[model samples]
Target: MRLSLLDRSRTRAGRPDAAALEATVARAEHAERVGYDRFWVAEHHAVPGIASGTPAVLLAAIGARTSRIRIGSGGVMLPLHQPLVVAEQFLVLDALHPGRVDLGLGRSVGFTPPVRRALRRDVEAAESFEDDLDELRGYLDGTGPVTARPATGRVVPTHLLATGRGIEVAARHGLPVVVGGPVLDSDELPDLLRRYRRDFRPHRDSTPWVTISLDVTVADDDATARDLALPEAWALAVSRQTGEFPPLEPKEAIRGAERPAQVRRRVDASLDRAVAGGPATVRRRLDALADRTGADELMASTSTYDREALLASDRSLRDLVA
Candidate 1:
């Protein structure tokens, strides 16, 4: 039942204005004080609505402001960057924060056609993920010498954010993995967890950790929870359908937009993945999901308009973990 904050820093209109950045940092600070185990920022590029295009830099900022809470990417989109550079960036983070860093890597490009072309990533590049992961490990383990001095002898554990065969790669490397999204059900995740546990070998220790991030929102009532979650749900749906990132609008506004029927379907599906309700209802859902999946840790990402309501959602999660 360990809890953490997952921030996307979504702006309402593709603008990460000064106010949004300030609010995000403040939220991270509040999360640390309120007993969150970690603060994970997502990496998205060329997405005007998301402020966290460079998660490593943002994590460094968050790390400097907080003492105990772990700070790292919810995941770094691996296909977009060189593994060595990523290793070095995180190596410095480990050097500064010691045991308080987590590096979660994901294989998805997370961008549209033009952006993917701009990044110069071919479809085959994703296949190199296994090689890149090994190279990163080699750099960290002191076996690779070129540009590897920073991370050598470091104990920073790396986790893979996987949906498919990437899970097997994580198991092979003996790293913890996080499985997410709507295609994953409570029943499916436990089997993956078992596979990881059975296959894991100790890079430095005998056992591996498993964590999952779920879209969640807790409010004083179910109606309010749904209301707060609409923006996030809509944005996710739009992203999925168009392969583009856009700022969220009110549900009523969305209904008025010239959206395709398929887009509406996608949005509905996104809403289904989100758990939104009062504290008691949310706790019941979470406990059921936990029992079903046996997830080692549960991280929550929320989208609420009001600062107070957002903080309340976080506080509710803290109480549930307690």
Candidate 2:
């Protein structure tokens, strides 16, 4: 399977956002050296742990630092921005990077009520995602209601960060999809993936390409790997309980922190869904998931408190997968 990187640009508990962003660029360069297919950055708003609020800006930096690996937004939330501006930003990336840019879009709202209000986006805003996608597609296809300048003339491959209705929308539009989260690790996801493939209708000269993405960290042993994976799992867990995604803390800190019973359950659930182990263990789990879903690529989203250890896990996973 093709391998790629999906960076959240995560901030450690004490580190500044700039450090996390620099880590992203450094990690992307490392990923390219280690034979990763593409490097996709995320977009998150008001999440202290995730510093990637503007994917286009982050991607431009990543693109400037890496010459070989494809770089793009793991997604730009389509409902959050105007179609024309989104198209133009990506087209600018295309102009700068030539044939090595990917445009992945998602339909998601800000993480909190205040954040949503700040964006002037409500939960209902998601309903217009389809319309926004059509406009973005039109711009890329050179049939937009208004010109998007260089974007109208240049071609950029697009993918959808999807699940549920999002998958159907992507299938209808014939865009490739990246699916992950706990759903991918479960038995039910294969059915959804199969249905997407069966229903997919190519929008142009294209075929469906599915990239399975989830948290992964491989170390010399199972315990160590799980340790490296703890930061991300803890972040997800707290996000569920407190309704805010926080930064990564050391594994020891997380293990000792006091959480309410319900929060503990959520934390355990978050930990359970991720794949973390030694090389052989990770490979086996990844192989099963890919085989079951027929994934074309593996987009790994791994982060931890120690940057060096995280990079080590990445290198180990890279060699093992390769």
Candidate 3:
């Protein structure tokens, strides 16, 4: 399986968001240098912890720094913006970095009610994702009412960050599918993938493609690896309970603080699912996972409190699989 990255540019406890974004560009260069397949950025709004609210802008910055690696949105929420505008943004990106741009689209709504209002979008906006995609496609292909400038007749290959319904959409359009998160940690993903492949229509570009994304942290030893992952794990659990994704606390602070029993359960549940360990152990786990899932690609969506440890894990994965 090929390795790719999905960076959210996570903000740590003591760091400013500016640094988190700069770190993303640096990581993109490093990913290119280390031979990663693609460098993808995420989009998250109204969250202090995530800095990648504008993937198109971030991809432009990434495109400026790296020459060979593929740059893309891990996904743009199609429901949040005008289809014509979104198409033009990516088309312009293609102008800057032709043949190296990918457009990954999703149907997710805002993180909260206020965020939903801020986007001028309803919660059920995703119910119209197919229509949005069609319009976007028409604009990119120069088949829409008005020609989308700078990208007329130019095609940007698309991928769908899919669930059950999203998978069907991709199949109909002959596009690839990016699947990740809790789905990767479960027993259900393999069957779902199998079903997708079985049901895919034979469109010109439609072959079954599945890229699994998950949190992976590696260290010289299992204990330290888990230690590195503690902060983000805690942040995620806290988000579950509070409905707000907070900045990542330092691992030492996370270890020193006290927590409720419920928080502990959430953390344990997360850590149990995340891939955290020393090299050989991680290699074994990753291999077994791919073998069972038949994953064509692995999107290593890893984050940690310490930037150095996080980058080191990013670099180390290649040798383990080599």
Could you say which candidate leads in lDDT? 3
Model 1 lDDT, full chain set: 0.77
lDDT (tens digit, per residue) of candidate 3 on 1-322? 9889999999988888999999999999999998998999999997989988999999999999999999999899999989989988999999999889999998889888899998888888988888889898888777888888795355887889985667677777767899876666666777787877887776444588888888878889988888888888899999988888988888779878889899999998888788999998788889898888788888888898788888899988866765
lDDT per residue (tens digit) for residues 1-322 in model 2: 8888899999998888899999999999899898888889999998888888999999999899989899988889988898999999998889899999999999888777899999998988889888889889888878888877675356789999985667778888899998865466556777888888899998878898898888888899988887787778778878887778899999889889987788777767766678899888888998887778888999988888999998888889889888
Error of 3 at 197 (Å): 1.2
Which portions of model 2 show Cα errors greater than 4 Å?
A: 151-153
Ten residues in sequence with the least summed lDDT for candidate 3 = 198-207
lDDT of 2 at 101: 91
Greater TM-score among 1 and 2 belongs to: 2
Q: Which pairs of residues have clashing backbones in candidate 3?
A: none
Model with the higher lDDT, candidate 2 or 3:
3
Go through the candidates in order and give each one's C-alpha lDDT: 0.77, 0.86, 0.86
> Looking at candidate 3, what is the lDDT of residue 201?
75
